[model samples]
Target: MPRDQILTFFSKYIESELGMIYSESNDFQLQNRLEEIVKLHNFANIGELYQSAQKGITGSLRQLVLDVATNNETSFFRDPKYFRAFENLIEKQIKGDLFSDKELRIWSAASSTGQEALSVAILIKELKQKYASDLSFSILGTDISERALEKAREAKYFQLEVQRGLTTPQMLKYFTKNDKDMWVASSELTKHIQYQKMNLKDAFYPHEGFHFIFCRNVLIYQSVESKIKILSKLESSLVDGGFLILGVGESLIGLKQDYETIMLDNAVVYRKKQKILKVA
Candidate 1:
């Protein structure tokens, strides 16, 4: 098949299957990725690759394409200031009368390999030790990749994954080094988090109403129309007065009208506006 035809075919397939949009300018990169898929699938050429993909031998091949096309580059505490602000927000929520119990529910919307969710759990544990409160919290981490979720379930990290945003003290307190010299998150920390596969484009929301949501960086890949739809759905999933934290570079501007942006000392977080009850 001609390069242009191959690019066009794959581009449309990706957009329809994964909600990914690629342009002709990305032809070289796309071709390289497709060539890798061809090798992996044992296709003789691009013609065979497309035919096999169309015939539904594309499940594994599709995952590879989505994994490569989507940017899943993430780190523990990728944004420090946002986390600091998160801690403060949790404390304030606990102190407020709005919530009768010390129950906090948080969701890491695109938790890739569980670092962000685990980090939040660790912070909660640390806070519990200091305050001596019987606080109940749940951290739910979801990603679209089954492979990534499997890694998250392992709760083990290579040297490189461990080096990011983890301090020596944290390493000592929350992790154990195996004989292989790899750092594994302590079972206690991993116990609080649950990892599941989720597609943000789908209408289904996590069952629980979230007190805090970290949907940072994932929206950049989505189209503006998709962004607005997803953000609106996310707002509905949040509790009244609940906080939504986005990537520093992301914004809700021209997206939704229900959330009010609050600038904290460390980060800017969005909160759903409280609805006032009118007396008859």
Candidate 2:
């Protein structure tokens, strides 16, 4: 097949499967990535790899493509302002007696390698220690890449990863170094988290809505249509009055969703507005 044909095929396949756009403007980047995969697996060449994938990209091959295509660049407590905003939300909710008999549920919708979710776990632990000793909480960390999910489940990070957003005291308190010098998350932190594989392109929502959803740095890769669709689903996945924190540059300015705008702790977040019932 022609090079253009191959690029088009893989581009369409990736967007369909992962909701990530590989537009013509970035064809060179995508081609380079495909070539990297070709070299990594010794696939004769790009054409040969395409031929094999054309037969059917399933199982391990598909996973390898996805793992490479995804940008799993994440670190502990990424964007401190976001965590500060979340802490403010928790305090406000607690003041309103929101957790009287409820479990605080948080969903890290694109929890690459689990740092974001684990950060929330650590923050919540500290909050509980300060005021709400009986506070109950659970965190669901989901990512489309199984490889990333595996790393998240392992709950281990290198020294550099641990240092990215952690204070020395925080690290010493919550992580222990293994023989390999990897900082392993303490049971106290991991116990409240569950890692799962999920593709946001799919229509999925938990039966019990989450109080906070972190879909940060994810929608930027998606097409505008895909972004709107995912945002709509995210809105539905949040409990009324729940919070949604997108990446710092992401916004709902053009979207139809009516999530209330919230600004706190130098971060702008969105809150799912309470639904009103009309009289019959």
Candidate 3:
């Protein structure tokens, strides 16, 4: 059992390190996650781990802590309605000449294990077949967890993982079961995605002009101030009039200065205001 001091200190450290907040209500939860790491490292108690963290210990242990602390919960086509809105946006943009030769960039800002990004790729493949043969998509999947990104790059998943939001048609259409009895995304389906590590709090955002961004389900972990800042950066990175898809429950509320809410069947879609007038 971890002592009270250890839990308190650990929670604060996690908040500082990763910008994830854990309060006294979450002590048991924190203890549960920490205990696994504690046993893995063969530490006698949580105190030793605490000491190591305070000493600025850098290694697998710290990385594991941050990785586990993050909510890596994701699945293909997570919140199906968002994908519907996405499909609608794509159809709209392509008709406006946004699909002409130039790469259609979509950023899955916190793509856990790449399911969401791969889902987008699959949808694009379908769209390309019908609307524009030459339309090319460049999907970028960014996560703070290197471990998650590694799995994403691999694009392999167990039966249960793929079952979350994929239909039989989608499964048979886009993935193949491997020797290990796991389903792997087909090369054709994954051809356009590039996975990389990015921290939302960091000042430097490397790429921009994305036509669509699936920055979903990640902002709930951050404080309001952090959410505002992150949303601002995400907004700035998008091409003018590009769409930003947040998780189903997340909203700009008093926060959407440059975005307007567009309601879908069961989700909120934020579209960035256009920079200048273009004759229709």
How much is 92 displaced in model 1, in angstroms?
1.3
For candidate 1, the lDDT comes to: 0.82
Q: Summarize candidate 2's per-residue lDDT along 38-146 as a digit string, tens digits.
A: 9887899999999999899998889889988888999888888999999987876666655343688899999999999999999888988888567789999999888
Stretches of candidate 3 above 4 Å error? 1-3, 97-101, 277-280
Better-scoring candidate (TM-score), 2 or 3: 2
lDDT of 3 by residue, 1-280 (tens): 4559878777877777767778777777898888877887788888887888778857888778877778799998888888887887777666764444367889999898899999999887888778865677799999988789999999999999989999999899999999999998999978798998998888877556888888888887777887888889998888887889999778899774679788866678998888687899
Cα deviation of 166 in candidate 1 (Å)? 0.7
Q: Please say which candidate is ahead in TM-score: 1 or 3.
A: 3
Per-model TM-score on C-alpha atoms: 0.91, 0.94, 0.92
Clashing pairs in 1: none
Q: Global lDDT for candidate 3?
A: 0.84
- For model 1, residues 108-226, the per-residue Cα lDDT tens digits are 99898888988898887888778776788888898887777888888888878878988888888999989998899997788788888888888889857888899988887677887
Candidate 1 local lDDT, residue 233: 83
Residue 249 CA error for candidate 3 (Å)? 1.8
Candidates sorted by TM-score, descending order? 2, 3, 1
